[model samples]
Target: GAGVSQTPSNKVTEKGKYVELRCDPISGHTALYWYRQSLGQGPEFLIYFQGTGAADDSGLPNDRFFAVRPEGSVSTLKIQRTERGDSAVYLCASSPGTGVRSGANVLTFGAGSRLTVL
Candidate 1:
């Protein structure tokens, strides 16, 4: 089966611009996640979706960041009023189900969509 897929591998925009990043998860996967990695920083969890609803969204930085998975297969992350600080590689991942294995969550990640806010 296909793995996770993200669109627009790279995006460059000026501050205050809005951007939408898309992700397509693997077939039959019920768990999906989004993470952001800033320069020199490890990827941080942004949100997690189980099916069509967001299960955990506390990681979102602010109201400017939002995500949706209306059909439980494709997800879109929407960023409003982008800023330089928001520049980073936005990664999308999916898993077979929700579980902590030996204290670590296993997931299959996309190459990522690098967003550059100038």
Candidate 2:
């Protein structure tokens, strides 16, 4: 795919279940990000990878959530003990690289993976 790809476009899980979301960034892109969006609200940042390592993960709410970008291309977001409050649309985005401080970098977002916790 020329753009980011998110797997399991939609997922329904019972409370306490564990879920893993996958994302494949555009070829050659070195910057990847994960975000979650609740109804009627903007997406909330989850984590970001500058290459094969995480550049920032402070947006993660707690230890129950984790993400990894091994080899600097494919990434996965893991959620433990899913709760109803965790239900939301998870979005993945990528950029060629973090541009200069001039702010010219633009991110391309995937269609998103919707998760429902019942």
Candidate 3:
């Protein structure tokens, strides 16, 4: 894909159900990120994958949230026991990468998956 692509542009699920959001990053991008944005606030980082491994997952809220990037390109974010408080727009982004000391990072974001837990 020319840009980051996310599935289920809008998802409405009941509380306690499960949800999976998928993201297909741009070809050749080594860095992929997941973020969640609440009303009137900026996106909050959920996880960051560098290649096939998760370089950082400290932003994941709890055990109910997890993400995987098995092929280093496409990724999935799984949410279990969804709660009404979890309703938000899940954003996915991909970047060329930041080398050893490169302080610049330009990310291309997808039209986020809007999850509405009712």
Q: Indicate which candidate wins on lDDT.
A: 3
Error of 1 at 43 (Å): 0.5
The pairs that clash in candidate 2 are none
Q: What ranges in model 1 sit over 4 Å off?
A: 99-105
Q: Evaluate residue 17 in candidate 1 and report its C-alpha lDDT on the 0 to 100 scale.
A: 97
Please give the lDDT score for candidate 1. 0.94
* Residue-by-residue lDDT tens digits, candidate 1, 38-64: 999999999999999999999999999
> Which model is ahead, 2 or 3, in terms of lDDT?
3
lDDT of 2 by residue, 4-34 (tens): 8999899999999999999999999899999
Over 1-118, each residue of candidate 3 has an lDDT whose tens digit, in order, gives 8999999999999999999999999999999999999999999999999998998999999999999999999999999999999999999999988687544778999999999999
Ranking by lDDT: 3, 1, 2
Candidate 2 minimal-lDDT segment of 10 residues: 97-106
Q: Clashes in model 1: which pairs? A: none
The Cα local distance difference test for each model comes to: 0.94, 0.93, 0.95
Please name the candidate that would achieve the greatest TM-score relative to the true structure.
3
| Model 3 bad stretches (over 4 Å) | none
